[model samples]
Target: MSQDEPKAKETKRLVVIGGRGDRAAGTVWLVGAGPGDPELLTVKALKVLQTADVVVHDGLVSDEILDLAPSRARRISVAKRKSRHSYAQDDINRMLVAFAHDGLTVVRLKGGDPFIFGRGGEELEACREAGVACKVVPGVTSALAAAAGAGAPLTHRGSAQAVTFVTGHASTGQVPDLDWDSLAKANQTVVIYMGVSTAAGISARLIDAGRAASTPALIVENASRADERRIVTTLSGLPEAAAEVAGPALLIVGEAMALAQAGTAELVSHVEARGRERGAKS
Candidate 1:
């Protein structure tokens, strides 16, 4: 039999396979579960979830989305927190390949667009090297949800002509080395993911690079979720604004952010406090 040829299964579920030579018996899909809201999940992702025999998902993926998978499917959580990983990247990759080799459909579900800092690329490489059939389903990244929930535009024709997404910390968990000169450019929006911890350094660097201290800034925490929060401030107050957030959040800086809603900072802080006290069920 040709290495790329798929052996068909007679189950009601339709297994979609992409032919690639020297592949394993089963297939692995990198599915994006989207930011928080189950409603935000793409139809294609929903279909893929329905057919999964084994699902390896990020810790942040909502419980509602996971409930969509078949009742008999095996679910594994690979949640990563600051300095704490439920499973190492190498281990996760091995699990996916091993599942596929057993002729099971595996779904490596991620909380945002898998390719958007979700380490989907690394998993994809691992699958290819293992000769496992792999495919991808993109999801709505948190940045877009953050902007929309705050009524801010990442790019506005009048105020912003460009948008840049950056991580605040490096893989080593230290402040990331970023180009302040370019990030300081006027008019373009800069969205920082996982930035709450490094807000002080990030704001200082941008200000030093000529970004106006008065530039508008927006912070969205637990974006798109029921416990979400939004804070609107100026570049000068970015760090202080971030101090109130205690969830997986994003920071947006640009003139376009001036249009965002901001009077709820105190109330949102209260809600977030209560949430933290109750603890996250997901």
Candidate 2:
């Protein structure tokens, strides 16, 4: 052996493999599938879906969007509903790394912007630690969909100057601890995700923080979907209005919500009518 030769390069043998040669290392793409509507998907996200070898997605991702993936791709749903998770976060993270190590293009498809309460950060961190090549393709989040569906501008020139997004429930399935005083401030729009079960508590906290009980509020369910429906009401009536919606919904609060194109009074009446019908059924 040469005196200066590196110890690791003792013997280099060039072996020839049969048919197909060694494949390149795999990569993971964290893609946002957008809110319900497939048309809202970004061009880059669509390309990834069409080319990926495997796709792991959440419950919120619609079937229409899933259909965009290539027919040869394997689709797995690790959807989380209410408190039920089909697969734990650790399991999903491991699955992505394993698939990538197998030289497959893996797509960790999530609903809405992956970084917005979608737990995409956890998955991305996993990839980083594993030394996997990862890319993020942003999509249209539900907040934007809800606002557009209702024709409500999140930040209005006169009524609202800032916007905030909050989750109603914490990881423990309890009301999330948030800054009520700041959330209740005027001239700001607050969009609460997964808040249907905690509507009453949210309303009480906001009222206690000096927000008016009569402040305009809107509950939009399945925003941007064909079955999308919205109920307009006052902050105090959030719980009552929320009771009428049972699908994936968002709670919008602020004076700017009053500017939505929908007829607030009529929707309020409709919600009240539906609530009465439900009570009669029970």
Candidate 3:
């Protein structure tokens, strides 16, 4: 517990693979790669990644993060886009389990927190069924990144008393069954993942369920990356705002979003203009 001990302490640096049972099987670590930013990776996740013999990552996981693994490590991308999956969930689970069974340390790198709509649960179940040891390393989900980028607090004492995360749609390309009634109540922030396509329907349902049409809304596209874009609007305008987003996006609604800043470029321009005017007057 000394500072020197802290400095000398090695992380979960397992260069050698070990597993349960009397076999040489390895373990599966579901590491969250964070929301597209390599620097956002946790220290533990980074250390585990260094020891990986194989990496199974999602499409959204940037190449920069993947490069952190030892150059000798094997990389397998199981990218999944809307309605297009290079490998089905079942297949991905099988791949992780199979890799671990071969005594190879496997890192299943996912963007954002794995459990948040990333289907980490299904994969964990598969590994348990196969008797493969598994561990999870948490990462900063996109919701936090998006909110931070906009300066919007997900829960504000005076405005947003609570926050909820919900998927935008189901596999059938339709709105998933959600408690729109509860969501319609004010004072709660609603962050919708993978919902840009069904933005119109989602807005209508919330409106019908008694949510205010003028609720402050924000659409963040490609959050936490260099190409990030933030659009601040209102609930009724969600459809139009979403129409401009072609990449992975999140739709956020709540009064707390009223404090959210507009795009960086516009804000910079506004500040610069004010500075010029003040200088001219002086």
Candidate 4:
């Protein structure tokens, strides 16, 4: 071999996990948008948002975070709130696949951790089936935000040995099928998402499963947001306490929740009054 023939030009080949004849496929990033605060976003999530060619986000993502993206990036809202859905789940999955096929970086942004009750698994499956590269960036879930905002510790030395996150609603908009017996165990905290509407049934089931009627329970609404509201009550008062909340709320049941910072006296009184009403009815 000749040593002076331009060193036989070394070619650097780019390898693509999934690519077409001449073009490499774009990647889809499933990013968690955090609870509600823009500042809560992970540094990598912020960078991905700023550089993505397209952002498909849920209702939980704040506008402030969206504004951080480049001005030219396209932003689409696929928010699903209770009974109303801006875009169907199937449509979103297809959309992500379609965007990646077009050789454009796509960001599928969800509120809280993408893997935690965010249907990120479904979307990730779709990407894999379509032969597209996908990456996940986790964000702090709302349960954590609720706990933080209320100054409550999800786990404590003697009060809570573990914590469980459960969805309150099923596909049928009914109480989700959860292991009530396990949740009723002591030294464990149970956090229910989208549980406001099913609080009555939840309270009844937990009580039937041996959870104490007087267990300290905290209902947090719009967690981490400026207009956050919290109601402190007992398991027996869950139904009435829930009736007083008109927004997205989380039901936290456990002894550790008793450490939550106290709310206004008026709110406390209201919770107590509702507890009394529920007791009178029983």
Which prediction has the highest TM-score against the true structure? Answer: 3
Better of 3 and 4 by lDDT: 3
lDDT: which is higher, 2 or 4? 4
Output candidate 4 Cα RMSD. Answer: 13.1
TM value for model 2: 0.84
Q: Mind giving the per-residue lDDT tens digits that candidate 2 earns over 82-163?
A: 8887667887787787677767898889999999988889999998998878999998899898888788899999899999
Error of 1 at 277 (Å): 34
TM-scores across all candidates?
0.85, 0.84, 0.87, 0.85
Residue 200 lDDT in model 2? 92
lDDT tens digits by residue: candidate 4, 38-82: 889999999998878878888778788888777777777777988
lDDT of 3 by residue, 165-268 (tens): 99989878999889999999999999999999999999999999999999999999888887788999999999999999999989999999999887853554
Candidate 3 wrongly placed segments (more than 4 Å): 1-23, 264-282
Per-structure clash totals for the candidates = 0, 0, 0, 0
Query: Which regions of candidate 2 deviate over 4 angstroms?
Result: 1-23, 262-282
Task: Pull out the clashing pairs in model 3.
Answer: none
